[model samples]
Target: MPTLTRLLSIIGLIVTGAVLSMYLLVSYVEPEPREIIVEIQKEGFE
Candidate 1:
């Protein structure tokens, strides 16, 4: 039981570290703008 607990704790730490690193990396980077087009039909009003 102790071994299992220790293993889980280690895994939890690794996952937490990975998530924090990813969050920080993304926060430091800039994103580019994307263009989108939409079309509406006039017939819908009638």
Candidate 2:
């Protein structure tokens, strides 16, 4: 029972490390905002 617990703990640690690394890598990505221009023609188009 003790051995199984230890093995599970090790796996959990590895998964946690992978998740942390992925989060850190994605934090560097910068998303640019886009500008949308709407043109309004004659008042009859309403």
Candidate 3:
């Protein structure tokens, strides 16, 4: 199985590349800050 080994190696390389790209993207990207608003009502208060 030389062919099998080669196939496995290719698959591993693809998986490694995908993981590296995802890590890079996550490390470099930033998320925006947002605020949350909530309103509450009581029995006697509007």
Candidate 4:
């Protein structure tokens, strides 16, 4: 039916808009990485 088609089209447009906005937002934002250090203890001599 025409109503079903219209609903799908609206949903598709909304999804597309949301995806584009998120892409732009993320592209402009920079993420900082945290540095992690790990140490291991040896009980026996090698």
Return the TM-score for each candidate structure: 0.62, 0.59, 0.63, 0.62
Residue pairs that clash (backbone atoms under 3 angstroms), model 2 = none
Between candidates 2 and 3, name the one with more favorable lDDT.
Answer: 3
Error of 2 at 6 (Å): 0.3
Which candidate has the highest TM-score of all? Answer: 3
Over 1-46, each residue of candidate 2 has an lDDT whose tens digit, in order, gives: 9999999999999999999886666554523212111223333366
Tens digits of per-residue lDDT for model 1, 1-46: 9999999999999999999987666555623112111112334444
lDDT of 2 at 46: 69
Candidate 1 ranges beyond 4 A from true positions: 31-46
Please count the clashing residue pairs in each candidate, in the order shown: 0, 0, 0, 0
Question: Which 10 consecutive positions of candidate 1 have the poorest summed lDDT?
Answer: 32-41
lDDT assessment of candidate 2: 0.64
For model 3, the superposed segments whose C-alpha errors exceed 4 Å read: 31-46
Which scores better on lDDT, 1 or 3? 3
The true-versus-predicted C-alpha distance at residue 28 of model 3, in Å, is 0.7
lDDT values, one for every candidate: 0.65, 0.64, 0.65, 0.64
lDDT of 4 by residue, 1-46 (tens): 9999999999999999999987666555734212111112232322
Q: What is the overall TM-score of model 1 with all chains considered together?
A: 0.62
lDDT of 2 at 6: 100
Q: In candidate 3, where is summed lDDT lowest over 10 consecutive residues?
A: 32-41
